[model samples]
Target: MERKTNLIIAFLLLICFGLPRNLGAQKEDSIFYKSYTTTNMEPWKKTMEKMAEELEPGNYKQLFEVTLAWYGYIGYCLGNDKEREARQYLKSGWQFLEQLEEMPEAGAAPHALKSGFYGFEMALARYKAVIFGPKSLSALKEAAAIDSSNVHYLVEKGNQMYYTPSVFGGDKETALRHYEKAVKTMEAGGKYQQKHWFYLNTLVTLGHTFEAAGYLKQAREVYHKIQNLEPDFKWFNEEVWPDFVKKYGYE
Candidate 1:
């Protein structure tokens, strides 16, 4: 009887303590995705603060995931022209990346993140492009060379290809190919879970790329797919869909 009671206590203790380490990552991912879809940064800010307080030393994987979240959040701020807020986050965000770089487990993802950070810096000060532009491209290339199939690297490379001016070697066709390949890789790996923020983001980018390249039919299809997958995707349903409809008359 005593052995059975002790076993029950141990099982309950395991559930209380051990499970959170695994669940913590999922929880953060959920918060990040929700914030992204809803275009609300408040929850994201709270999660960042909480993670910063709770993260233990040498927990490289959690550090990496949190850093990626910071990268996304900083990008969101920059996209909205909140330069000051972006800069503030950039300060701590870079610290996190630097920590990842020093870890033995660090891989291509860190370089890819550096590429994104450089791009953000260039956006903040166009004059810095002369210095940061090549750095951004070089980091992305390094990341790709290290892990050619890395989804994050592929996405960043596609972004660069899509956004850079043609004079600087931007090719919409190349961008489309990269984005398509990234999406295919994710789908093939069964990584396109409905709650996966990055997968959804890649889809949205692909749709925008299609629209930019005048593939209105494909763009509409992609948007429709997103609608079916997540009808409450705030930015897509509220803003992207309306503008797309106004411009092209959705089928």
Candidate 2:
């Protein structure tokens, strides 16, 4: 009878202590994904603040996740022309990237992030292009050398190809190829989990690239896939789909 009571206590203790950690791990990913889909930054901001409060030295995984969240937030700021906010986040993001760079456990992810940071810098200051443009490409190349097939590196490379000027070798066709490869690789690796905001964002980018390249049918197909996967995706259902419909007419 005593043994059974002890076993029950231990089981309850395990549930009480262990569940929060697992939930914490899932919470951040879910928060980021929700922010990405809904275009709402308030919840993401709270999560970032909480993560910062909980961060500690040598907590590489936490640091990496927070840094990526910051990256996404900064991108949102830039997209909305909130340069002031983007600049502030960019500074904080660079600090996190520097720490990650010193942690060998971080692998090539830091380099990919560095490439993104440089691109963000350029976006804020076009005059810095001559300097940061090469730096961005070089960092991405280094990231590729380390892990050529890294999903993050593939997405960054596609961004560079898609957004760079034609004079600087930007090619929509090349961009499409890179985006397609990234999407395929991610799908093959079973990376389309519910909390995988990066995979969804990559799909969104691919669809936009298709549209920009005048592949309306392909773009529509990709959008439909996104709709099926995330029916409540606010950015898509509210903004992107409406714009697409306005221009192309509903199918």
Candidate 3:
């Protein structure tokens, strides 16, 4: 009985002592991974979210509204199935912009707001077209009104022209004119400037225009530039641009 009792105690001690060592050894040289979420966000989207959180919507109603408009519009545009959401956001966005315009934000805010509002309006057109028919031209015109010097918007307008019938007002002449204006605006440092996305768009568009105008040098330059970019860049770049450049020689 004494011997059996001693053996039982020894077994209990081994069970408690042995397991953790084995477990610790298993994990001693083991590696774990830290990963980023797959979902991506734009700088503007992040900025908008951050700033919105910092502000008081109730106290600073108008300012808060402007932020909401920007956030909502951008969020809608970025959504996966964004058509309906975009429309809803635009309606809300426009309301905010209108209020702000009537009661202008009186300081450093206006500069960004001016540019951002125009950009929002441009996005609105793209969104509008997805749900309804062809209201993009009008919205583009309105955005141009806010900042006529934006070359990118003009090019976007020109791009939209591609979808419209020639009789309704879409013509290569108009496209060429918009493209030329965009080039001039960029060269002159106009209100509309090129970030990476805009720059890429410009390069590719110029390639297309040059292709049509028989300038393969410009075309190849754009294509190769696109090819050299990181694969995880943007929505269109990851998917559509690869085949697009390959098929047409980037022009």
Candidate 4:
């Protein structure tokens, strides 16, 4: 019972981070992405291959492991097939989740993690709806039930709320709440795998959210903080400044 309880806690935690299907990524992937530059995904490809080689066969537990491995494979695929690869992994994620739910141990952390994994894929599916057809918001709703405080999925959900049309309940106020929750949770946790990106991404998202709400000074501060951290980061000098000028008419 104790072990089962622990598993439940862990699974819920994993789901919180895992189910956010946002294929959107962090500054670390940025390092890899910068290196690829339409020419060098081989490194990414090779890394996924190595990881896949070490994968264990699927079990009722740890199902998300397989899903995650496949996700790595799709994630490494370049350019034209990026979403295709991601979708393949998404399919794999759902298959694992099916098996996971059949057991009474659905309360386990692994099971919860599997939920997160599928939710993540679903979220990505929704975002890629332009290419992949219609989207589904069910993933976020389900994930929140599993673990309301899961920062990773919360962050993705937060972004969707901010960007999605009002017909979809994509309210800026709600999205900002999720984003703020994600930031606070990550900062407090401070030791997760995403610890490295959480701080930076949080600030960037905050800036973007505030900017959308027409808070220029706050947005500038966020960008300025990022610039202080990575003085040469291209997003600030290129994409962000141009957008600021075009939209806000900031000189």
For candidate 2, what is the lDDT?
0.88
Q: What's the C-alpha lDDT at position 164 in model 4?
A: 69
Off-target runs (Cα >4 Å) in candidate 3 are: 1-39, 42-46, 53-80, 103-148, 190-217, 226-237, 249-251
- lDDT for 117 (candidate 4): 51
In TM-score terms, which candidate is top? Answer: 1
Per-residue C-alpha lDDT of model 2 across residues 1-251, encoded as one tens digit per residue: 99999999999998999787668868788888888888888899889878877888898988888898889888889999899999998998999999998996977778988999999999999999999999999999899889978877888898999999889899998889989998998888753564588889989999999999999999999999999999999988988889999999989
By lDDT, rank the candidates, best first.
2, 1, 4, 3
Candidate 4 lDDT (Cα, 0 to 1): 0.56
Name the candidate, 1 or 3, with the larger TM-score value.
1
Question: Which 10 consecutive positions of candidate 1 have the poorest summed lDDT?
Answer: 188-197
lDDT at residue 217 of model 2 (Cα atoms): 100
Model 1, position 184, has a per-residue lDDT of: 87
Off by over 4 Å in 4: 1-42, 57-135, 192-199, 245-251
Model with the higher lDDT, candidate 1 or 4: 1
* lDDT value, residue 117 of candidate 2: 94
Q: What does candidate 1's lDDT look like per residue over 1-251, in tens digits? A: 99999999999999999898878777888888898888888999889878887888999977887798788888889889899999998889889989998899977889989999998898899999999999999999889888977887888999999999999899988999889998989888754466888899899999999999999999999999999988899988888899999999968
Candidate 3 has its poorest 10 consecutive residues by lDDT at 29-38
| Residue range with the least summed lDDT across 10 consecutive positions in model 4 | 20-29
Instruction: Tell me the tens digit of each residue's lDDT in model 4 across 18-70.
Output: 75322323433543444333335465555434434554454432344344334
* N/CA/C clash count, model 2: 0
- The local lDDT score (0 to 100) that residue 13 gets in candidate 4 is 78
C-alpha RMSD by candidate, in order: 1.4, 1.8, 16.2, 10.8
